[model samples]
Target: MLERDSPTPLYEQVEALIKKNILNKTWPKGKKIPTEAELMKKFGVSRGTLKRAISNLQKNGYLVQRQGLGTFVQADIEIPLERGLYSFAEYFQAHHIDYSNKILSAKIPKKTSKVIADKLGITINDKYLCLRRLREVEGENIMLIENNINISSAPHIETADFSKESLFSIIERYSKETVEYSETKYSAVGANSEVSSYFSIKKGAPILYQEQLVHLSNNSIIEFARVWIKSNHFTLKTILHRK
Candidate 1:
């Protein structure tokens, strides 16, 4: 039952309900959804309301409407990142999937580059922690992750061994600050020579590049990351909110 008197719009409530069905396998891949008239009658909403809901699901990669056969659930990816942040180690452990992190470098750099300085809101010569690692599954590396952390926000953070501990965990535990949220942008980028060497792939391989800035409870930015993920191993799904 949707909350009719709530501030949330009726169509958005309908969209959430339909998306839940798709996620829980209630509506399997390539399975056609109910007709618009049937959905309208069932939800007690107008055609306009229902169409907006379906249109959003289609745009977000959960549904596809063929020209002739109506709408069906899309063929999805192995992993989906909706709106939350996932520490790869914890996720793999929860699912009982064998995975390991090989730490490439984790230390406080003497001087940060201009790009890193701007991201962390620090001066170019100021100290900041940098971490680079490879995420391996089944003997193949699929992700290269690099993190630039605000040293002022997480003082003495370099003392912790990232290979044996979670970065966010250490930050929250030691600094007594909460990681509130993150802003992320996703794009397709071709791998250059440095990245190609890490993945053992040729230069110009298609890869998913994600840039993210994490904020603390006080709304100060604390971490910035550049993640290169093999397209074959992951999929990213984000919701659309017009307001």
Candidate 2:
């Protein structure tokens, strides 16, 4: 309902109502909404007004239009996991999608940096398994993840094949511990030389960089991870509720 004195246009009010349905999951991902005529009848608005509302939502990623077919609800642009709750695989599983990982680099590197030692809770000279992997969704390369694991904590690291098995699953199987939570920081940065080549994008292309520290229920750091994600492949959501 548009109020004449509210300063918002009728089309904009209609657009907001459609968006509310989307956010509330009334129109789930990949589902099609009413056609233009149907929406016009339902909202009691003009055809031009309904079209304008749909157009605005499409531009903002809430709806996707097909050339011959009517518009469908967009695939959820964001993973719904909270910042500290789940692993990447958990998030994927919740969305009913399969993800594959390609091992790019793996080595037992001597931990020499002070920062690395502090995070891993080990001596500067302790050993760590440094691993780099590229993750793909629906066969599209979308993220590059690099992780450092304390060798002492992960003693039987070579037994499992990462390509077929889940890294967190294997770690829990071997260590008899579960990751309870994690902390991460997100930022945007230009791809570096190696990252640029690995992602197959241009050198200066923007990427979403996520740095994570995964912790076990025992309060030990389980994984130190850094990731570079393709710019538009993913989105993050945070909810703010007023008390």
lDDT of each: 0.80, 0.77
User: Ten consecutive residues with minimal summed lDDT in candidate 1?
Assistant: 74-83
Question: lDDT for model 1, on a 0 to 1 scale?
Answer: 0.80
Cα lDDT tens digits, model 1, 133-196, are: 9986544567899988887887788888777666778878766799888888889999988888
Q: How close is candidate 1 to the true structure, as a TM-score?
A: 0.64
Instruction: Give one clash count per candidate, in the order shown.
Output: 0, 0
Off by over 4 Å in 2: 1-77
Checking candidate 2 for backbone clashes, the offending pairs are: none
User: Estimated TM-score per prediction?
Assistant: 0.64, 0.66
Best by TM-score: 2
Query: Which 10 consecutive positions of candidate 2 have the poorest summed lDDT?
Result: 76-85
